[model samples]
Every structure is written in C-alpha cells, then in structure tokens.
Target: MSGSLELGHHSSLHQAQDSSKCLDEDGRTKRTGTVWTASAHIITAVIGSGVLSLAWAIAQLGWVAGPIVMLLFAVITYYTSTLLADCYRYGDPITGRRNYDYMATVQSYLAGGIKFKFCGFIQYANLFGVAIGYTIASSISMMAIQKANCYHKQGHNSPCHISGNFYTITYGVMQIFLSQIPDFDEIWWLSIVAAIMSFTYSGIGLGLGIAAVVGKCLQLHTCIANPFLVFTDHFASETENKGLKGSLTGISIGHVTQSQKIWQTLQALGNIAFAYSFAMILIEIQDTIKAPPPSEAEVMKKASLLSTLVTTVFYMFCGCMGYGAFGDDAPGNLLTGFGFYEPYWLLDIANAAIVVHLVGAYQVFCQPLFSFIEKCSAKACPASPFITSEIAIPLGSNRCYKLNLFRLVWRSVFVVTTTVISMLLPFFNDVVGLLGAIAFWPLTVYFPVEMYIEQNRIPTWSIKWLCLQTLSVTCCVVSLSAAVGSIAGIINDLKAYEPFKSSY
Candidate 1:
C-alpha cells in the first residue's frame, strides 16, 4: 500500500501523441502554466473578500496580539502547504502520477476510508459556503457603492439605506455564466484579472488607512464613538495617552459584554484563518505547472512561500493601518464600511474591484466541486445525452464553447440556491468565520500532516511525528473555539434580523 499505484501514463501519452504534438507525460495537452500563473491563482484565492474583514478582526484582537496571530497562522499554513505540495504526486515527490485535486491527493496518500469521505464532504461544503460568503461580500460592496454616492449627494449623517438582496441576485446571475468555465486551466486569464483586482483594492485600502492616520496625526481626538467609554475602565487609558484607541487586550466589557468579547476574539481567529485558505486549491493549481526541472512540489513550495510573504505584507499593511486609522472602531469591511467617504470615485473603484475579484474567486473555489459532480453524473448515467452531450457555441476566430445541458442547469441551480441562502442569512463576518473555522483544521491541517507522514514513512510517535501531531491537535482546538464563536455571532445577529428584508 505504501508503493505508488500502477503507472498509467504510457497508453494515454501514446494516444495523445497521435492527435497532437504538444503532450505531457500523462498524455494531456501540454500544461503551459508557469510559476507566475500558479502564483496568480494562489494570490487570487488568498487575497479574497476575507482581507476586507482583517481590520475588523484586528479590532477584536488588540494591536499586539492581532499581528502576532496572523504571523503564527502564516507560518503554519506555509509549512503545511509545502507538505501538501509534496503529496501532490503519489509515492514520489517528483515523478509519480499526479493527484489532480485535493480529494485525489487525499485518496492517494491517506487511502480511501471514512476520513476520505469526510474530507470530500467538508471540502465541498466549504466550497459551497464560500460561494454564499462571496455573494454576501460582493453584494455589500455593491450596496456600499450606492451608499457612498448617496452620502456624497446627501450628508454623511444620512442613512442612505440600500438593500443587498438585489445585489446578491445580480452577482448570482454573473456567476451563472462564469461558473461554466470548465476547469482551472481555462480560467487562467480570469485568475490573473482577479489577482490584479485584489492588488488594486488592497493598495487603495492601505493608502486610505495611511492617509487617515497621517492626516490626523496632530489632532487631539475625542472619544467620538461614546461619551462613557472614554472614562470607563474598559476603554484603556492608553487610548488617549498613546494616540491609538484599543487596550492591550481588545474591546472590553464596557464596549461589549465579557461573553461577547470572548466570542469576538475567537471569531477573529477564524477570520485570520479564512484569509489563508488557498490550501484546498493548491494541488489543482500545482497540476497546471508544466513538467518541471525544479519539480512541481519545489515550484509550489516557492509559489506558496512567495504568495504567503506577499499576502502577509498586504494583510499587515491593511489590517494594522486600518486599526491605526480607526482604532477600536475599525469596520468589518475596510473599503465598504464607510470609514472613508471622500473621493467617492476611488471608493467606487475599490468596491468594483472587490466584485470583480470575487467573481473569479467564486469560480476558483467551485470548479473542483463542479468537476466532482459532473464526473459522478457521467458515471451514474453514461448513456444520458443530457449529461454527456454538448452544444457548440461559437465565439468567433475558430473558438467555441462546448456547453453541457446538465452543467448549465446544475450550476445555475447551485448559484440560485446560494444566492437565496445569502439573502436569507447575510451575516457576512459570521459566515466567513464559520466557514474558515470549519475547514481550517481538517482540510488545512490534519490531512496534510497525515499525508506527509504516510508518504515519508515517518515512524509512529517519533520526535518529528509527535511534534506534527501536537500541532494538528492544537489547531483542532483552535478551530473548535472559532466555530463556537462564529455560531454564537450568527445566533446573536438573528435575534433582530429579518430575512430578505435587511438593509444597509
């Protein structure tokens, strides 16, 4: 069982060569993906709607602990991701047959079992949750655009209420067409576009934060949020003494209940965890890299490292600057939270970029799930034309899309379902945290550690083995707490919320 599966490359290679000159060892069309493309995919996945919430997450965590926690997560994710990379090809880190997706990678090294099934369920469920989260996130940004313009026309004090329900439906309609992208390779251009948009908005958020902090550097600010908080023990004296507005510990009892503070801190961990969740898609991205001198694992390690470094830098700038700017009052979404309303055009661009980035990110997370369901359908009904047949739709210049009826109907239904759910329960921060807390340990930690140990033949309870297991167990506890916190948040939100009628 430790040995690699039988090599099936030759027959496919031979057949592929007969029809085309460009072919990989597995007899597929040559993979043109380079380190840049792979990195683009990783960035697009990593720097998603999650980053918008970083400022709020940090608000829950004080300045000292917030960045520290982010660094800890970054280290853990990078190390485990490299392990996942090593497991991408079964039985050999370099030359063995590929595991095309996360489930395949799990099946290869860990073997098919209950845990394997659990991985599939968790992965797909997380993907679906991400879809809903993105819908909620993008709708908020769209509504923010309208609200921002309204504030320009009206005063800053004007409510400028806008319903997110329409925006959610609009995003779902956009996804219905985009979701038809067959696979990761086909969506390379989209990923690149999304990655660029991520940078655009991230830079804007960071700049706005810096501008806010510097613009008020000399001002002796009042405790504008609350009259009582300024003098209360909960609002630490350091807020006035030091020019920032949070305690060494985060928001305290005067600002919120003790229980709420506890839950918010744990929920903040989930938000940080969510920001580093490209692991589920890492193998699929690695599968795209052309046959390598450095090896896909090595290339992925580099990409992982680079992407992690880049993301950490962006996150720190955005989160820290945002916290510095608004202090304890930092909003859930840095751009859409109305922290900065002037130069509404810039705010408009940043929000537009978020919408665009999420469109591609949605497809990125969903493609593997789409592939899984379609494969199952073909297996179940091999003779059904509805499942297998495709209609040729022309795009001119000798280009055409093979549109599948089942894919169309099924993906459309999936989009609509997520859209409706998002409308019903559009608690954005809570949803993001819950999804992250649910997926982080199992998908991001446990499986990778297990697979790496199995593939490397690491002996039971050896020093390295014990250390790795300890890390996994620790992450499990963290995930549990984050989940509880997020669930509590959602319940609290529902106390006053009306489904499909909530407005911003």
Candidate 2:
C-alpha cells in the first residue's frame, strides 16, 4: 500500500527514471511465496474474529436470506480481488514490468491529484482500524478463555478473573517485538501457522454447534423447524420477562414488527460484508508470489480462488450450524459464549487458537502501516541510519544509536496508542460494522472496478461497464447507510452502558 511512498524515501527521481534499467540488470527471478503460502496469507487476511459473529448475523436474516448474503459478498470480493491482481504491474504493460503495491496501483491507473491522495488516506486509515480491531478482539478471546477455565476449575465465585486490558496491553507489547521483523515477505511461515489456527477454531465452532442441535433434537423427538423454533421450544416459558438476561433467547422473524425486521436485516448485511473484507491488502499479498509477469497474475488468481473456496465452505457450515444451535440467542463469539461445563476443554483450545492466530494476523494487516510510517520517517530524516542502515559509517556510530532508539520508541508508541483506544471502546461487532461500511466500497468494490474500467479503457455505456458501475454505486449507497445505522447503534449502546459504569 505504501509503494508510492517507498519511492519518496528509498529511490530518488534519477533512480526512478532508471528503474527499467535496474529491472533489465536484475531480470525476472523467483520471489518468495508459492501457491500454498500465498493462499495462507489470503486466508489470514479474510478470516478473523468476524467469523465468530456470523451466526448472529445470519440469525438476524433467518434461514433463507443468510447464506445468500454470505455467498454474494464472497463472489463480489473474489472478483474484485482478481481485478486487483490484474493491476499489480510496476512498469510497461507488455514486456518488462514488475508488480506494484496497493497505493502505487491507485497512483498509476487512478491518478488525479486529489483522487490519488484521498485513496491513499482511506486505504491506510482502514488498515490502522484493522490493527486496533485485531488487538481488541484477541484480548477479548484471551480474557474469555481465562474466565471459562477459572469457572471450570474453581467455583463461579472464585477470584480467577483477569482484566481484558491487561491481556490487550500484553499482546501489544508482544507485537512491539514481532514488528521488528521489518517486512511482509519474511513472514510466510507465520501466515501458514495463523491459517491453520483459523481453520482449527472454525472447525471447533462448527462441531459445538452441531452437537448442540443434535442434543436438542434428541429431547424434542422431532427436528426443529428453524433456529427460531429451537428457541421457542426451549426458552419460551423459562424466563418471566424477556429482558437483559434473556437477550440470548432466539428472536423469531415471525414475532418482530416490519420496522424491527428491516433494521436487523440491514445490520446482518453489514456484518457479513465486514467478514469478507480482504481486498485492501490484495496487492501486498500478491507481491509475495514467486512467479514472473503473466505467471504471477495466474498464481495470485488461483490462490485467491482456493482461499475463497475454503472460507466460503467454512463460513456456510459454521454460520448455519451456529444459528441452528442457538438461534437468536447465539453469542457474539461462539467460543466465549460457551458455558463452562461439558466442553470446557474444547472452548479453551478454540480460544487459544484465536489468540495465537490474531497475533500473526495482526502483523499481516499492520505491516503496511508500519512500512508507511517507516518510509515517511526516512523521507523526513534522509541521513538517519534506521532507513539507510548506516552502511557508510562504522557500526558503533552515534547515528546508529539514534536509529535503534527511534525504532524502539516509535513502534512502542503505536502499539500503546492502539491498545489504549481498544481498551476504551470495546464494542467489537459495532466497530467492525462501522469499519466495513467505511471501507467496503472504496477498498473492496469501488477502487478495483474503477481502476479496471479506466485502465482497460472499457466503453463507458456498454452493458458490461454499465452493470459494473451500477453494482458499485448500489453497494456504495447501501454501505454508507449501514455505516450511519451502525454509528447510531453504537451511540445508543454507549448510552445504555453509561449509567451502570460497566467495563469490558
């Protein structure tokens, strides 16, 4: 994403003009990643804590509408990813070219002074938001694991609780050490491990959901009509009043008024859309592929297709099973919501996977931001050893000392800042909706389609072009509406929580 800024610091205008010469001297060479490794990076980018809430999202839409929305988002995102892959070229289109990062792609094809600047701003801003989201979500998962373990081993009233912020701050400090790795391409092995963790937790969630449904079915002696029916049969007469404690009881589509139904539907749309947001970092991942030119594009496309296939299957299975098991009462996070009893060990394993996966996933998303800051700093301090490595000076020079000091202080500051904000407002689902709404059109849908149409000089009024444009505009409007609604919901939730001084 910071490819354009990389020029500002790493290469001068003279060097930029001679890039073609350098490419000729270097020639085509195998890069770092293979199809499997690249696919792992895509999986790490696509799957996150968002998967945990997809059941609640589907419950809002009910049985018929849920899968449709999830699949639709998957298809839209996959196509946009391919469009991004096509724009990865760094030089001339035909003969001798290299791949460009996200921001550079925008600068190359969509360049108009203000337009390019705005694109860069939103791209990086969305990335920063993602970093915060990962930190916050990971901490919540860790905290939940600790709480559940305590309840399982000791009594419910035992003093085994730890603060969520403590775990978040600790994770942030760990990131400070991990971020010292310096580049994205160097972390393929880490991404692979993270991908495995994602699959493990997702599978565990699916198993728990299935088991819940089977257990319910055995008691009823008949299959439940839907998730709504499951809730009605089990909990309808159990609670005296449907209030805060009873919030988990399933809400039936048949019971809600038209206005309430529409509101919930839109909220579900926002959540599913948020779950599939990985297009922003497509180019950066593409840069890791080993093949050259045309082959690079093909390799990236295959990786994307494979990752989408895997995630879609997992998503459908988990979302459907979760809704079936818990209906409207499903917890925001399936693992955290599990009661600390029969399957306590499984819950612990799942939460541990989540925490570990986020550790790696955070780096995948935040490395771009780190690179951007480093480039900006290098541009400001041309003589600094942090960027230049002080090759001209002795290893023990004072400039190198400043460089080490700058690295520690600067990175620690970013980590601490994100950790503090995450501690302040820990509404994971609503925050995700807002981030998705803000970034969905620009990052996932708009930029790629616009860049494709303009770059290829596709006819403006042709049916194909018109259809793409209409889809883009429709999604932009819907996402903006969803974003506003999410903000309103967040405000209401804050007001509701304020009187009690409840802390996460």
- Write one digit per residue (lDDT tens) for candidate 1, span 429-476: 899999989999998999999999999999998999999999999999
Worst 10 residues of 1 by lDDT: 233-242
What are the Cα lDDT values of the candidates? 0.85, 0.73
Which run of 10 residues does model 2 get worst, by summed lDDT? 238-247
Point out where model 1 deviates above 4 Å: 1-22, 29-37, 181-186, 217-244, 290-292, 393-401
lDDT of 2 by residue, 258-317 (tens): 655565566667778888888877887777776554566788889999999998988888
Q: Against the hidden reference, what TM-scores do the models get?
A: 0.87, 0.79
